[model samples]
Target: MTQTAQLSPSSVFVVSGGAKGITAECTIRLAQQQPCKFILLGRSELLETEPDYAQNSDESALKKCIMENLLSQGEKPTPMNVQKIYNKITSSREIKKTLAAIEKTGAKAEYISVDVTDTPALQEKLATAVQHLGPITGIIHGAGNLADKLIEKKTEQDFEKVYTAKVQGLENLLNCVNPNQLQHLVLFSSVTGFYGNPGQSDYAIANEILNKSAHIFKQSYPSCHVVAINWGAWDSGMVTAELKKVFQERKIEIIPVAVGAQMLVKEMDNTNHATAQVVIGSPLVPQATELDSELRTYRVRRQMTLEANPFLHDHTIAGSPVLPATCAMTWMINTCEQLYPGYKLFHHQNFKILKGITFNESLAKEHILEIEEISKVSFENVEVKATILSKNPEGKIHYHFSAQLNLQQKIPIARPYESINLEEDNIITTTGKAFYQNGGATLFHGPAFQEVTKVLNISPEKITTECLWQEISDKQQGQFPVQWINPYTIDLSMHALWIWTQHFHQEACLPGRVEKYEQFVATPHNKPFYVSCEVKAKTATSVIADFIIHDRQGQIYSRMLGAHAIIWSMKLLRS
Candidate 1:
């Protein structure tokens, strides 16, 4: 790094969206150390007459807001939250007021109103600014906005609106500005891009683009010092009252203007250019859970019962109900699809059943679905690990199921089905003797989860079944929030192969993993359906198959490419 260099008298800085913002605060702070002329660019013009709200009456308006905040806290105005409100309430026509404040510090300042996204227009204005204010050397791109909506609610327009200023604006500036003339370039990014946030996915994605761009520019333009500052929430910007409460709950400290600006100056002055990307605030990204990664409260507690979860009462072995692994996947898939609208679960890897979920007559009142972030990754893809836990009366959390999900942003409309064709009379049917030792007309399934009425055919090569739709119980229907098929029926259809496994492999077997699964339609549950499984790969110890379910009319409902299971007797440790 070069010796602490001071701003030269001829230095001219172009601050985008800096006409009136925390960027203005940083400009004033820069003036305290060394004087430099600033051309502040923004979308709004500095009016000859100040806004009606900027009248002397606003001083009272500001006080009124602070007083209400203090009343809610049941204390007098403290410097903390009061400062948050004070910074936000200031009006923007104060652009002229800001220029005057900077001039008082012996730094020249002027305002220019133009859309930063307008490449041609910005080029012209930038050229004119150089003519009036001398050479353009320093650049601070603070031009960005927040739409702040969950991914499901975010429209394409909202993404574009938030993206253009930071991503596109930076692109245009790099194209228009002469790299030889530039000494310092500052890109204002955020911690959300580094980790991940719930409502700010779009914004986080945009800033991430900026951070990558800054690094690339640094390597290409070796003469210019390109630095991307990933900042925490600042006191003097677009942050509102409600957002402040959220930050407090998450324990994210808001960077005071003076400190934040001072840090900005020091970072810019680092002449070595070794630091391409610098995170200013101490951002503690939570590794424990998904909501934690998003700065939200993670724990979810709910009351669940046999009546509420009718599917839970469906399959029982030796008088104990077992929750199917696929049933849990159903809930997780439904949820994530809603949370991230455009993303689809492409594959499920390493699904484990630690202990089966069993419910007595009283039912376990509360169970928790722990959604944790294995990693906050990729602009278009995310991966998460989930656990289904039950709290016992003694207050111990019992884990029932766990799995890793592979998510993709692009949604697939259809996939090739595994074709299975056979003669009706050639395949032999079996009764309860194969599944239950009692050898009656029933196995482990109750009326609701028992969709496979009869085995149409069975073999090592293929397995097909005849199924009748057991009307989804009103009590259980809400549990399947996904508009398509419910897990109960899907699990029942897959259970048809249980008889095959019992006869050839062992007395009983359980699902080990689902390598891949896909769905095209939420097939109607009221109509009779056919589910056929074709053996993809097989071994003496394990079996893998592809399954496809279709209604009588041949409309495909769901498909599984790599469903696998282990032989029940093979895992037995004792005779």
Candidate 2:
């Protein structure tokens, strides 16, 4: 049987901050894509009260210069689309002109000038908009103030000014939206909220509150989707020439107009969650180094190292001493790295640690010990054999030996000299020859055969067949608290590495060490020692020794061994 599908109602969009460049363009584009009724709300009037006021002397001059620049570039200067939209929003003597302009674009547009923070006025405006248009399916609450000032220097009035516009205004708008009709709510926050910037405390706090409010709303109303968009500075009215002058003097750069708007719109369209943060700038995509420059706390580093004895407890251990510390470090680093990567040497700290032992030496020895025990061991009914061999040019040579007395099983045992003689065989023997525990067996060669070759010479004939060997236990664990003399070290390194990898390797980049090594300087009678490591490289080959490790596989194996040792040690202590 065939079924007819019913189409859901098209989305109706209401956008605040229609006067802002990015927000305005985003709102219009959203209406165009969804074929929805639109309501553009802002404090400023769309149409100028007077024709003379509409075309300011500076604006006219700017327009003339823009046209002249275009002609000189051999490009035809069509009337700017932005100017048309601006004229429609600001030129209309009344609401009719604005609606007509919007109708021409195949969408209905309405304007409301009431302050969003005025609850009653906002409610009335919302009702009027819905009656004239339709139900509101989406809203872009972009209205907010950008009042920048250092936290210590900022006044209570400055704090109120920003919060009144961002938090209060947003709360009023949220109150106006009918849950049954509203599906998505996009809150315009700023990067300042995610990562605080100096000389922007007021702005940052306001945006942060907005972000938090979105989360609260989402938690309270699961059906409604709330998104918090953390935008980088964009070329808009908020960043006017006067404001730009202030920022430039303070060394802060505003983002390009087009780029900022594109990022904001992209996030608005794709995001649907409570408290989702999306950044609007280039630095944020690859990594937010530019923003990090201003937010010092957002620049941190993390590192970890793991040691083990296979015989201690069934020879099984697994852990990184730096694990907990590294974990906390990673969190701090990621948070700061996402926010700021440029600021150097700003000290702030937080730390944590966790450790545990799962087994002991007594437990390990219970199941594993001596060649006789290994030979007599059987999983099911299969008999096992234990033998030792010496390395030769031809291959390994098997050694024959024995244990005393009783033979309860049909297993075979081959042990060499009752006491290993270093002079003759150059081999060492331990009291415990072989032992099995935790699904594996461990064979110990005492202090006399500590070297690799000594043990290799007396290796089992059929190593795998003789016993199943697992990871070792009883290991050493430790962590380091690293502080950078210059915090920009990691940030610059990451950026340089990223560029090199993208331009040259075109392959995944590995984490490279950032070390300061100690060296000795010697004079005739006096000697001094210092530490240093080359931080930069002119060629990839030059970086091999200092930045890259050739034996990563071996390093990883060693780390695993260390982890096993730590785990086993902890276990032993616990037992």
Cα RMSD for predicted model 1: 21.8
lDDT of 1 at 209: 92
TM for candidate 1 is 0.47
Cα lDDT of model 2 by residue, 1-575, tens digit:
11111112356677887534567666555544445577888766554354332343355664565566567778776787435434553434434444554566577677887777788988998898788677777778888765676578878888888889888887787678776566777888888787666677778788888888777776666565667877776777667799677566445668886565566556555543323555554222121122211211111222222223222222123411111212232233334322323322121221112222124321111111112122211211111121211223455432221111111212222232122212322232211222212221121122211111111112111000111112111132122212222111111112222222222333223222212211011101011111111133333322321211111111100000000001112232123
Off by over 4 Å in 1: 1-6, 50-55, 59-92, 284-575
Indicate which candidate wins on lDDT: 1
Off by over 4 Å in 2: 1-10, 46-102, 237-256, 259-265, 268-275, 282-342, 345-575
lDDT of each: 0.70, 0.42
At residue 572, give the lDDT of candidate 2: 29
Taking all chains together, each candidate's TM-score versus the true structure is 0.47, 0.47
lDDT of 1 by residue, 265-317 (tens): 88867767675788877563222223224522134556655666665655655
Model 1 lDDT, full chain set? 0.70
